[model samples]
Target: MLEREELKLYNRQIILPELGLAGQEKLKVARVLMIGAGGLGCPVLQYLVAAGVGHVGIVDADVIDISNLHRQILYSIADVGKPKAETAKQKLEWLNPFVELTAYEERLNTENAARLINLYDLIIDGSDNFTTRYLVNDTCVALNKPLVFGSIFKFEGQVSVFNYQDGPNYRDVFPEPPPENEVPNCDETGVIGVLPGIIGTYMANEAIKIICDIGETLSGKLFSMNALDNSMNVYKITKQRQAISAPVAANLAASPDREISMETLSNWLGETPDEICIIDVRETYEFDDYNIGGLNIPLYELQESVDIIPVDKKLVFICQTGQRSKIALQWTESHLKNEKYSLKNGIKHNL
Candidate 1:
């Protein structure tokens, strides 16, 4: 039974035919776990709480930083230096007292991901790293829980619902992670401030729809949007009968010569200055997080313009962690003959 104040708070959403009192009550009984308290997480958190999500768990290991202010809307200048999850909890509580918000100020790694996810009915991924994203997908798939996923690059964003009722998980669409150094995080590159807001809202919409069984869920489909052109595209994805293996373990267990690290690319940037032929694998938003100064080529874009990379100089690659940079090195070797490059691990590692 919704309290009088709760009904008043959610009156607008309750009025929608798709989401009347019954839907609202369904929402009140649902528990959503949002991974990452960054850009996408902010908007998703705000809207879900405002819509009366009964229990929302926020998981983020990072603290509020000055640079995050541009896109992570949940915090203020005063909130800087505080734990992101804790800060979001405060704001969400203010947004809807009817909802219960739990803040987990810890990073989600393989060891603890399953345990944490087991506590909630649904998981929303706003995490910027591929490792966490893959982990979320695998755990959800194994547990038979649903996941709402969102990601953003320079001008493009993606939204999808993975592992819903054993529907195609992310790996079903992207069976393998892009080669090392391929996809940079927002911290490594830079993202349009509004990109995450748009994608995150769409993610929130998907979560609500999944909870109430209202509209079409983005299951077994990838929704790609280009904010620059205001054009949208949907690609059908099929889950292969094959089990989705752990991409990281596959790459890590490879031979030494087969193994590589951005920081150990002696063949590429051993002696060259940081400026010449360096590629930033971090996403646009991530590049703005912290940078050692380099070219703004995101990981996803590098494959298309490999020739544009300077051959006269050695190329250095960077990303959120070393994973994407390693992929970039392999791609460069496989495609371009004149491109000389090495990986720089991540900005934090170099710093």
Candidate 2:
């Protein structure tokens, strides 16, 4: 049902034998939801809109920072401090006025994950952290939706399609999230500027193929690429239906009961500094560079040094973001009888 103007606009793609008018129509009617508007999201959003995805929804609560300009190509210096989803929507609409775009300027949490995901036919994850990635994958599995997943670290990138046609998913590959300290994100370990572009384009290609029914999708395999060495590998992954373990259940629960906001922590520290004990669970280097006055106890050493933490004071655990702190909170809750809390969203949000 393409109008005259729409046909002319997509003439180049319409000419392809594998994707003629019918395929173009399929693209026109497809609904896509992108989880992040960061490094990987920039290219995926650009190509999807240019390819004529009829309806695109962007979900990201982050604002643009000067440091993001290198990999996140959609924004300019002027866009710093602006909400990513809204800025991306403005730019995408200009790229293809034929497509409709919706911007959700909020983070995707457990409470709203299901509802937001249900609104779209496909979910493309461009998230950087394990927490959101796991949440997205689990939600996709629960809703029986296809998820195009991509991640970048240093010069390496990985892409895959999960929960498509009963295929293996993120959990099927990793089973459980890695120890937060074991895996460093792009913020801690820098990525090559073009790595996300390469992987994100592949993700966009998978989405296009899925929508047009053109070729085989990466449903049961993981695609890994190294930009530095130009090495590529595809690994076969199998789904494991084992019952969720206690740790995995704790992660899934994502309870708010143990979380303390930055504002609340600041106020408490100001009024009764002696009553609070902040244990920074980040790596030593991270703590040495910048810290908000806390005892540095790297997550890997927490078990050996658990006894050092004071049980009398209101214990608050913090890490770079919040994933490690959550894990630390779980460990402390199981072993110690102290009043424990995790800084909500970690120190990153506060800074």
Candidate 3:
């Protein structure tokens, strides 16, 4: 039951024939957990809050940096170095005081993923890495929850609905994580500031439609759009039963062994500067703005520059958020006989 003030606040959306007062109430009862509060999460959080989604939870361990300002409009220069989930909760409360907002200021790892995801009615994957993406997808499959997935790189973005009423999931479409170098994220390729806004709104739209039972949801369909040309395409996705087997779920939940925590890296940089070789695999522009001092070898150029990398020292690869560094580590391990490691959670945690 909406209060008198609540009805007035959402009058515009409530008047729609498809979304009457009942639909508004459905939104008020829906529980959504948004994963990541970065580029894509910004607009999804904004629109859902405005629409009065009753209980919305934000999960992101990262703090804001100046580079995120151009796309993550929910934040400002004042928010730099602050936890994203907490900051989003504060601002979103101001947007819709009637709504309930929860912020989880920790990374969504295997141990906590199921516990956190089970609390929500739907999961929104705004995450940037393949590891987290696959992990979230498998968790949703195991728990039988719907997932609204979105990804953006450069001028293009993709949006889809997965595992809704036994629909195709993320793994059904891709099956395996792409070779990291094959798909460079917004951090590496550089997205036009408005791309996420366009994509994220679509993701929010899917969530609302699913909750209200209005309009055709993108279940088993992948929507791809290019902001440059404003061209869009929708492709039908088929489910592969083997994609969500027990062995696959176990593999997805397993953590890698080559990751070094932020604290350990800091200690090494201080105590063994000569024994450690830090390599920044991010793009040149990212290194120029802010870096912890390392050889700038973008992931694309890593194969050609293998000769310059030292094989004797403990080689540590670093990137904006660690995905590229993991890829760089794989390449270095194959090419050079060195002790390889990747900075866990990436440099974003340090910033």
Candidate 4:
């Protein structure tokens, strides 16, 4: 039973026609785990806490930075340098004192993902990369849990619910992981601050519908939104293959040392001269905004222009964030298997 103060605290939500007392009660008992405390996580966390989600777990290993203030609205300039997850937990606790907020000030990786996710009823993914995105998807599928998904790029965003009651999962739509470096992150490519907010709210809405058992769930549909046009499109998908292959499983299991932290990358940048061959995979406009000194090659143009890359030099791939760089590196590796190449680390981290 909820205390009188608790009841008073959630009165506005309880009075809603769509979300009545029962809906509020459901939220009170529910446990949710959200990955990432960046742009999308900020809004999702705020509304979920405000709506009285009984227990919420936030996992993020990042510290607040001034650059994050544009979209990660939860943090203030004063909060910069503080651990994002802990700061969010403190703010959430104040928003709904009746709710319990858990903060894991650590990155969500393959080793800890299963254990961390096992404690929750549902998982919300605001993670920025294909690696973490696929990690969460596979883990959620293995546990047979519902996942609220969101991703933003440039002026667009995508939202969906995966692994919900035998619905078409993410794998159904994107059967194979594209060779790394194909997709750039918000930081690498630059996202309008408001974009993640729109996507994050959609993720929160999906969570609410799943919690309350009302409205049409975006189970088999991918919702794409273009901020520039104020347009929304939903593409339905069907299950093509079930049971990921052993090779795919092995790939997931493989811990490649290709990844580096933004801090490590920054350090390397400071120590090394610009003589190394660095390929920046972000769009041209992004090159104009802010970028490390590197050769610009948009992701889509890489395949046709592979000939331009010099064979003798040690190639280092970079992008807005590391996502596209990883893809580009993978593509470069397969095409030039005998060539020597590597990837630069995080674009947003330490920046």
Residue-level lDDT of model 4, residues 93-115, one tens digit each, is: 87888889999999886557767
Per-candidate RMSD, Å: 12.2, 9.7, 11.8, 11.3
Cα lDDT tens digits, model 2, 1-351, are: 999999999999999999999999999999999999999999999999999999999999999999999989999999999999999999999999999999999999765776788789999999988889977876676556799999998999999999887777787787546766798977788989988889999999999999999989999899998999899999998765421112322232236878889999999999999999999987777888789987898765676787888878988999877766766676566667878888888887888
TM per candidate: 0.69, 0.70, 0.70, 0.69
Off by over 4 Å in 4: 243-351
lDDT of each: 0.78, 0.85, 0.86, 0.78
Residue 326 in model 1: lDDT: 54
Model 3 over residues 1-351: C-alpha lDDT tens digits? Answer: 999999999999999999999999999999999999999999999999999999999999999999999999999999999999999999999999999999999998755787788889999999999879976886776567899999998999999999998788887787547667786766667989999999999999999999999999999999999999889999999876432222213222224678898899889989999999999977677899899997998765676788998777998899876765755665455477888888887897789
Candidate 1 C-alpha error for residue 17, in Å: 1.2
Give the least accurate 10-residue stretch of model 2, judged by summed lDDT.
Answer: 242-251
lDDT for each residue of candidate 1 in 224-260, tens digit (9 for 90 to 100):
9999999999998887633322222212211345334
Off by over 4 Å in 1: 242-351
- What are the runs in model 3 whose C-alpha is more than 4 Å off? 242-351
**Against the correct fold, how does model 2 do in TM-score?**
0.70
